[model samples]
Target: MLLGSMARRVLANAEGERRAPRFVFVIQSNGFDAVQACPESIPFQKYADREKFEQLDLTQHKLPKGLAALEPLKGKTTIVQGLSGRSTGGGHSTHGGCLGLYRTSPASRSAHNATIDYELGRAAPGILPWIGVGMSAGQGDALMHYTARAPHKSMPIILSPEKAYNAYFSVAAGGDREKDFHLKRNLLDYMIGDVKKTRRALGSLGGEELDAYLSAYDELAARQYRLLANKDTLGKSAPKLDDRFTSDVATKRL
Candidate 1:
């Protein structure tokens, strides 16, 4: 009986050690042709109707040329076709509405509702709840809003990997990077103080805009402190800085 109890405890421990599954959404702007991800084993003629639900097991079939790199992970991958978001607007991109399932355009700055990615990020909260990294063809573009947290709220996609790295891992990185991290923390402290003073000066006249500014500053300052508090633990697992992080090439940065 003791041996059986020990075995059950071991099994429970193993189950508890299992990591949570991560969900990743790969989106493409400028109209991604679904044919690019279609399996080579299936003929294009088979999909001409485009009115039926079709599923392909990646493990049993060869991936298309564009997705050839994912061959090794084919067994774990799934390719679904015939899904459409007609309400997202007709254009090269839907901006915020693609994930929110509402009508929005490139000129629109906000979303009609929280996107799936944002909801998932909230459900699986991290030190930084959701980190978005992307690259733009345009030169010197530092960010793009591709996701939304709620109505009138948009998430910033980090276009510069360097900036993203600094935001994520700099606190644990030694040398000048660590110093810079502390410097930013100190700046946040100063800014928080200044914001408090500004709030006092403006009184009720400050309105929601000033309150929003103060809230943003407070959130950033809190993050800085949290990182500093966990620096020792973070240092053990932080990724080492490499050329890929600083690369100018869009693909490499991604």
Candidate 2:
């Protein structure tokens, strides 16, 4: 999550402008039946005959049982289908393969390459650029591994609504925005200085690692500066805390 914010800030700092067209990837790990997502009015047998390209008018047809909830917003929604994903490999679960277009192994349990979400996140900048929130049946830790930030690196999903709320709305907590801002600013300044000192005393490989660290800290500092400048606007737009925001349930997190 921190990496995502820093990446966005870095892009803004480099370009001297904020980029439009932000992205949010809502990944559902569980398998979904494609037939159930299609319109009920469309015959499955006819649709399966994929020898040629075809387009269906959803307006004239009733939505499938699974997608009935979207009826109210169907006019605004675009349902895309008939896309081939054979290049990603066939399996019960494509894992990171569907996004990266590379085969992933359960035994390895890590991405062999960077996923599409990370690529888009790097291009678009925001306060919390790429938020990974979802429900999981797994126990112990609330983080459900989803997209990969880089090769062999899995991005952690926040499975708890309470934790996710705290992370996103920490600035609005206790109505002490000025104090929180200064504390973060001071911390970033300290880390930036420490990284610079360490980078000067390191070898080429070590220096390279420190350089990345330095860039992240620099971007964070810049983000802090911007936040401070827009503190009033932030407070005005901040969400109000409620039962939904404080809930620990996995479904609520979604």
Candidate 3:
């Protein structure tokens, strides 16, 4: 079990008030195209976020009936394609698809190391932001989650449906959106709390990466903190998430 999983199980016995969530996001990798093949998936043409397909004419880019099964999720997804993460990983075949998910830079040099997932998670490891799943095969070496520049510590991918289900259903140390405010507010507070100690430990100056990394972390914390305290974060305004926001019901040929 992941460390967070264990913590939640232990915390289950505690008595406390329930808290609303700050946000929720999902990632369905290579299997998404396969899932889209479901007759149910065709409705995804209706997805609202980042509607790159909004202008597409179904007749030209027809989806297969296999996608129809995924229709129920049409309004909730952000169907993205051709998003370049990086390039190089395992040549044209083996399984480089994972690397392309979000590397952003060229694959040759853009290390998927400690990707955003980890940065976000480590940013707040308590919540376990990255609920990982592997499709058709195992979780593989690449991290479904990542830091800004580095790939997460490599672990075998979760390649089975049963494994995915188990991970998804397992208990976890849940984070409360309301309670998160203090944590976010204090992130810098806590870090800066020891600024003198940190300075003393590091001596007169810090390196470029450390300085930049700290600034980035601070910016992230401040934004999240302010968003939470002020209730100013963006909503799930995508038309697919809520149809009323959409311009029209997209009618596709396939």
Candidate 4:
């Protein structure tokens, strides 16, 4: 939620006003001990009120041993504490509630509502609003929705590195990858044309429902155009494929 709010602020700035900030979020499912982040200089009693909010100057105190790696970025970093997750319903794992802040079951395949990351992704539009890559606890699970894009819709987390590489960086790979990209663009074009014909056939019968579908296809077609325009940049930044991408080890996929 904090990242989403910050992204909105940065995006709201007029051109040349301020540079956008890059944000990365890491999720660890293992249990977390509050003391691991609590500085040695601060007393535990200060965090007794879980609902309260407190901010401290990192310059005046040392970060806990676990978070020492953030020393270099202390100036831009903020550590928040005492935020309550009472509504998440305490358990071995909060499932979708970990991000949605509402009770959810691990067995469920859909989300109750949009997650913070989804809202952030939408606020800062892109060809692919968001991409999730993570290891799944279930054996041989190559994809999972530990997150959501909207209510009743779960965002996919690409668990296979090979699949992830192709999904994001394939346009730069040339050969089959580039061919696949063009094929998808062509498919979208066909779909848009078909939808237009259908809408026209419906005439006065068509309502916001048809308009919504048309608008979605239009946005997708626009993304393809943007991708083609930035092909050079994509080629320059695409990661080189290697053994790790196809490694049998689950952690290597990350």
Q: For this target, which candidate reaches the highest TM-score against the unseen true structure?
A: 1
Candidate 4 ranges with C-alpha deviation above 4 Å: 1-19, 39-55, 60-69, 106-109, 137-143, 188-226, 250-254
Residues 1-254 of candidate 3: C-alpha lDDT, one tens digit per residue: 43774566457636463333233333444334433542332454332444453443343343456544434554433344444433523233212234335324243433345444434554554333344443332334234222232442332345443333223321121345334445556766677546545656787575554555566556546544444433322222211223322223223201
lDDT to native, each model? 0.76, 0.67, 0.40, 0.73
* Tens-digit lDDT string for candidate 2 (201-221): 775756556776787788668
Report the C-alpha lDDT of model 4 over 184-228, residue by residue, as the tens digit.
Answer: 889999999998999899997988788877877886687677778
Candidate 3 has its poorest 10 consecutive residues by lDDT at 232-241
- Tell me the deviation in Å of residue 44 in model 4: 5.5
RMSD of candidates 1 onward, in order: 5.2, 8.0, 16.7, 5.5
lDDT for each residue of candidate 1 in 1-254, tens digit (9 for 90 to 100): 53784677678778895333356666776766788978888877445666766566678888999889889998767777666777788676677777778887757747788888879877876565566777777736355456877677677777777787787788988889889999998998898899889889989988898887787788778878877887887888777678988787778875
Candidate 3 deviant stretches above 4 angstroms:
1-66, 69-87, 91-177, 200-205, 229-254
Error of 4 at 63 (Å): 3.8
As a whole number from 0 to 100, the lDDT of residue 207 in candidate 4 is 88
Tell how far residue 142 is off in model 3, in angstroms.
Answer: 13
Q: Higher-lDDT candidate among 1 and 3?
A: 1
Residue pairs in steric clash, candidate 4?
none
Q: Which stretches of candidate 1 lie over 4 Å from their true place?
A: 1-15, 45-52, 139-141, 229-237, 251-254
Give the lDDT of residue 215 in candidate 1: 77
